[model samples]
Target: MAVSNQEQTPVEAEERGARARTARLMLDTAVQLMQGGIVPSVSDVAEAAGVSRATAYRYFPSQAALVQAVVDEALGPILDWKSASVEATERVGDLLSSSLPRIDAFEATFRAALKLSLDQWAQRQAGTQGSEPQFTRGHRIDLLRDAVAPLRGRIPEAGLDRLGKALSLLFGIEALIVIKDIWGGSAEEAREVVLWAANALMAAAEAEADKS
Candidate 1:
């Protein structure tokens, strides 16, 4: 029996909704485990969430995949960040201010993701990471590029790219780990350092642009 498109549309939507709900459940479970200082595998999360292993595996095939999903969820707000300001410096400042607090709050989760990525790197170096999906991290690139869009023509193309890359260092978990953990700075101190570095980078870029 052939189903009309209209008849199948609602069914497909419902199925998608169900899948999304299940995936969210697993992610939430994973985050909880991560917060408790446990790096959970997909099977661990599935068992905790009361979901079937096969269905959970369909959503996150490995520990790396599961942790990556949790990290992405933690960073969902930053990924959707938008600024209406046309001033590149203001736009970048706003993004850093808005995102730094979120990163501080999820410090543990982000550090865990970093640890997993480093573990993968080490395993690959030892030729032990056979066919496992790698969890790559790059959200800061697009966000920084968008923040500096107003400076696109003002700065040389290579300069714009360099600015974005430099700003990326100040935007994410790495900054928190450095300023807060390694340097023993408070959250407020970390934010100040990041803002200072970001502004300095912009000023240097602007100065170079003036010379050129």
Candidate 2:
């Protein structure tokens, strides 16, 4: 018996929905494990998610892949960052103010992601990471550029790039960890300090642009 196209369409849609649900379950489980400070392997995520190892591996073939998925999920909001401000400083401030709280909320997950990246770095340095894919980090670059987009015409291209680099230093989990953990500041204090530094850096960049 030949199956009609209409019948096959619904079947395909149902299959896709099931696959998406399973993937989401695995990702959510991986994130929860990361938040608990356990850098989960695919199999670990499978067990915690009550999914079969085979199924979980199908979604994320390696620890690096799994961890990256969780990191991307944790960064969903920040990645979608938007601001209505026309001023470069104001846009940067809005981005920081809105994102700092989110970063603090997922501090543990971000720390775990950072740990994985550092571990991969150390392994590569020691010539022990083997053929495993390295965990690279750099989402802040684009976000910072977007935050400072309003200054492109006003500042030189070099100045804009320098401003982005300076702002990146004060943007992500690294900054929060430094300000909160190393400096023993509270979350609010860290946010305040980062905003202050971010604005200061922008002001300096603008002044430098004026001079040039």
Candidate 3:
């Protein structure tokens, strides 16, 4: 079916532009609040952005929407990452090298996101989660699988999955926090350790594939 023309009228266009500006303002405010390690609600962002609660709610609708927008903004570059290397280990190293620093830079925001995820988990366990949307996290799974794509035909699917799970323990904000916070190591140390672990996992996967 040929789609009919549905262009907006001049007034409608102007209204859309205004709404877009307001949404951007609210989203920017949310990012700023999250950067301070605060998983802000829509009302919090509205107050910070000087926008009315009604208007902010119109754009974000819920805390889940607002926090998710901030996460997508923070995750933009890492999600778009691609490697030129053909070797699985080298590609994994490249990804870690490129992504760890970015993750470090947004450390506070990610930690705040993690806090939200954990809070939702606890609330759910207590049956007090109410209608609040649960915060979700698992981007590392797909990323790790892609990084290890070179082993697709070499290893069993279960082996590849296990490798992804193992490497995940060494990736993301948790890795940085464990190395930097618990062990009192620096960001560089975290990066080196993650890179080393990822390479080791790749080697293990390749060896397992050889046995198969």
Candidate 4:
């Protein structure tokens, strides 16, 4: 039984890859559970992943960590869309159109994440660091900027703030909740409504710029 450092390197790499794969699998399961209305707990996820509870805890030390991981895992495509739209479009309308479809695909996850947003805001207002989603407002603002870049010339500098507010109000989780929970739209319909509203806002901004 001889163990050499040289021979251990490949084995270590394999172990690392396996751990990464396992972590990813656990995250995937958590997302699916969330989508399925399961409200997945660490123990539930560990059971689903066939890992020990301690192993799950090692990867995600808290419920917030697990929830954030699910949110991040689901946003991969949205990030890609932002990157692509940032590169391809020269007009705001086109960029909005490009981004909306990606946003549509991930609307449910966004809605789920938004469920606690207002409570978090209230806590922050009260001077407590509340449990917020993994993503930050700055990240969302960056995404908004990316979606608006194509309209830079057409949307006046002064109007950018208004446009940002309009888009943020119309396209986010609260909007989804209003559509689904308050307004009684299905998830699919709510996404379509948000996309339509986003497109309309972009088009209106363009038209106003053209008039001026």
Maximum-TM-score candidate: 3
- TM-scores of all predicted structures: 0.90, 0.92, 0.94, 0.68
Kindly list the per-residue Cα lDDT of model 3 for residues 132-174, writing each as its tens digit.
8777788888888899898898988888888888988987999
Runs with alpha carbons beyond 4 Å of true place in candidate 3:
1-6
Pairs that collide, model 4: 92-150, 92-151
How many residue pairs clash in each candidate at the backbone level?
0, 0, 0, 2
Residue-level lDDT tens digits of model 1 in 93-120:
9999999888888888888888888899
Query: Which is the better candidate, 1 or 3, if ranked by TM-score?
Result: 3
The root-mean-square deviation over C-alpha atoms between each candidate and the true structure, in angstroms, is 2.1, 2.1, 2.4, 4.8
Residue 18 Cα positional deviation in candidate 3, in Å, after optimal superposition = 1.2
lDDT of each: 0.88, 0.88, 0.87, 0.67
Per-residue CA lDDT of model 2 for 120-199, tens digit only, reads 88998999999887777888899999989977887789878888988888988988888777999898998999999998
Which residues of candidate 1, in runs, are more than 4 Å off? 6-18
Q: Which ten residues in a row have the lowest lDDT in candidate 4?
A: 86-95
Candidate 4 residue runs with Cα over 4 Å from true position? 1-8, 82-108, 118-139, 153-158, 186-192, 207-212
Better by TM-score, candidate 4 or 2: 2
